[model samples]
Target: MTTMAATRRMGRQSWRIFSMQARRCSVAHDHTSSSDPKLTNFGYREVPENEKSKLVGNVFTNVARSYDLMNDLMSMGLHRLWKDRLVSKLHPFPGMQHLDVAGGTGDVAFRVLHAIHKAEHRAVGKLGGKSEAKNETRVHVCDINPNMLEVGKQRAHKLGLENVEDLVWMEGDAEALSLEDNSMDGYTIAFGIRNVTHIDRALKEAHRVLRRGGRFLCLELSHVSIPGFQQVYDAYSFAVIPAMGELVSGDRASYQYLVESIRKFPSQEKFAAMIADAGFQEVQYENLVGGVVAIHSGLKL
Candidate 1:
């Protein structure tokens, strides 16, 4: 046989081997050895779909007390500004019925509630008299982790809002919200959807719970694609975040998983497409911190 022919044959064999290995890895990563379809990602590893939530719950339970502190240290307190930007995009108003899922710490919920009150007060003052009807606004804070919810409740008490009639806390799963159809005027989830086992199901649930013309907004850590900045951002994420998590929360493994989870999540465009597929319209997103985080928005219209 000619040397060139032998080279061609060798190339074909190498390609076949590569393809076979890639397929095997893909199947194993998405399913068990028995080819079970009920497997999902837990960070970089694959696990039973039913177990992901419990694993995630334990992680949060371990760090619930220091979650906020870790956020401050890791992001240099920019999380607050990112959340405030989310609320401003929400355009909250009086009499709004908002559901803040995966927001057990009440960060987003508190901002929505405060925005509603400020808007209500401004309208009341403009009318030159107090309205007879009280503001019927409600902000429901929901999370899958009870420990995180307890942290939010304590914060509310510290702020003297424990007795506030408009605030409600519920422990609920994002993929299967207990809310009625057409129930909420707005839905927001900050840094939460990435932790869900089925992000598409959670998006559909967000659409289901929202009334017509309602909006869905999500704030999450996302991929970076800038020229030189991407490398710097990645280095910080992999090295500094876990260290900060250990120093502040004493849970290095959980923070390491969190960083890997962000990498495993879909890109901003792909996630926006998923939201649109979930029956949301007018889908859009804004990248913050050069794509360290992204805020995706959609309307139920």
Candidate 2:
């Protein structure tokens, strides 16, 4: 049991490990999977609907070790900022429970935990705050890929965040979360909802698992709609992105699929409507980086 003083002493400097890992992503180049034809887009190419998850799973398995690095390289480190924005808006309080779906890297969980720590410490005005573990502000990080969950587990330990339980490192799908209905105080899936085969089903699952007043927050790449900026962003995403993936992950095809999937995603307005359809209320979204990405949030009212 680390004291708040000791934990605080460990310092926020540790948070930069994620950044360093990202920076470590090789600028060097290399080149690299997939399923069915029932018909889904595997990066602009249609494939069996059932095949998409398997194909996406393979992409993650191949790059799990370098996933953070690739994220850094691809987003030029902006991903960290976007995640930070998500956590800040969450405003997680002590003893609040959260579920970070498809965020197996512990990225979103860590931020919420950190925010809780900061808040509690501020309230107490000391280093070693009382354990909230009994009613801890817990976050269950769930993902379909074992490799990705393993990486998330490793990151959680590296950050000295193992005080929680196995619920923290769970294996589950977005479309059918294993968690009980109305069990969590918050639900978040950053840059992951679009990958689901039935995003509507996933949205409903999100709504189902969250307690009344719980919020569903998602951060994803959005279609750049501004005329001039859209052209430039499109060129970069279609051309420079996969090329960057080749350099960083030695897997151009996987990255190409990622970029193409973003293009396949619905516009913000339509997506917000889906959330509403899924039974979430007060739905809204905000564009970031000139519409390169957006954060959509709703309440399970």
Candidate 3:
């Protein structure tokens, strides 16, 4: 089938699944005493909520080796542009402290450091100051996947980042961050929020961790708004992506699940509302690459 036709079919299938879910919920409410085990949909799979992390972990573990490659291939290297845009908006100061939650491979953290260094260099050149400058910037990269964190740590070391020891690689859940409250100057997550089963809780955690006026930034795959982009995008995601995964990572099913999860993710407006509900103010989003991805920015006030 053509890309357009395939996308239409998938949209229809998604609608059917939604309808089925509504019917099931209605029936369950009617039979309150029924002992039918409750089921939650995790990317079209009916699984218990508690089981989702393990399943998601398996997907990441399977694709960890080729995850970065897949990102480059799928986005035609535009993912770098999207991330750069996010970093630009952040405009990290030399003294800023950031918590990068779900920062699986420290891509965002590394970019943040680069932005800070560039900003500092520009400031010094503009001012022509001879005073000693202090680099107070620090980033804590937190993720649930230790394997990903280990790889990221090695990459950081290879880059010869002076404060590599300052970059804490913590294994923690977004829903319940282990960090102390009101301790972070900024919080960021890239392409990670959708994998979270409890997005609201995660947002709450973000709010709790961020200091007043601190920024919360998220870069995620969002629903496309263009006339024909969704169809083409879906076709590529569903068809070519898995094949690329097989070729690069020797894992096809993991990539397939990633595509489905992106489809299951909430719309940009819906997600912005969720962020607002979690006490973030001035919530805004910028679409990248014809709305295939979005960078959402909000502040804790």
Candidate 4:
């Protein structure tokens, strides 16, 4: 699949809020830049609004090779469990069309495909639905980073899914999807929504692309709620995670940015509200690991 980027000029109000968040994140990260009338946040640092996506792309590029490794190390292998939970919630089946946006690593797509295979295998014996089992299922793995897309393709190949015609790698922007409206049965963005420059716009695109009764699910790092555990989590996020990134990926700044971006994201309730504002129904979120990660789900009703 071809990759397409979404770039648009920011409105006055949105730009103003983004600018202030950039400055606040800068102060927190201790990376000060000159005051500019036009700016956006690049992991706690303010840069030209137009340059933010490029800077973010560079960060992901630098760590693309080590992204999964760092995820395991930083989360102590919990990322996999979190992702598995997300896939379980998706409940993919034969003939389903899923769009795994921002899942450049193909984890979500892989799990869903495997689940479909498992489900079809079981139903084939009892129902003799061999033809149904052979349906052309598709999972479009879309991301903004080409490097990440390459990694995901390599992973799919490694998994012996090279013969599968269903997995398609696409480089796309979440804010403005290249896909047709109401074309997909399900939309998933795991650990990807927080990276979007405009989370609400991304949600709107998700709404647009999903057919009626389709599901929209997003898994992301969120604020920790446990009283004492919050402090412990913060220390680990600020200190240990970045150090691990430096040692493993040789890029502490990128991991530092990761931590700060999580900090800057809206809380569970607030984010759910944004999803509702984007015109979803029955918007709700499940807090995982004491809200260190959250899974928000809605239906395009």
| lDDT by residue for model 1 (178-217), tens | 9899999999999999899878789989999999999999
Q: How many residue pairs clash in each candidate?
A: 0, 10, 0, 0
Off by over 4 Å in 3: 1-38, 126-135, 162-165
Cα miss at 82, model 4 (Å)? 0.4
Minimal lDDT window, size 10, model 2: 24-33
58-167 in candidate 4: lDDT tens per residue? Answer: 88999999999988767767778889999898888787889999999898889988988887787787786584746678889999999999999899889999778888
207-244: candidate 3 lDDT, tens digit per residue: 99999999999999877755465656666777877898
Model 4: lDDT of residue 282 = 94
Candidate 3 similarity to native, TM-score: 0.85
lDDT of each: 0.83, 0.75, 0.77, 0.79
Give the C-alpha miss distance for residue 6 in model 3, angstroms.
17
TM-score of 1: 0.88
Please report, as a residue range, the 10-residue window in candidate 3 with the lowest summed lDDT. 8-17
Which 10 consecutive positions of candidate 4 have the poorest summed lDDT? Answer: 4-13
Give stretches of model 2 more than 4 Å off. Answer: 1-38, 126-134, 165-167
Instruction: List, residue by residue over 1-301, the lDDT tens digit for candidate 2.
Output: 3442332222110111233223211100000011221455565576767888999999889888889998876676778988999988888877778999999888888888788777777766554656554356677889999999899888877877666652477899998889899999998899888788777789889999999999999988875656555655666667777887898789888888887777666667767877888898999999877667789999988
Better of 2 and 4 by TM-score: 4
TM-score of 4: 0.86
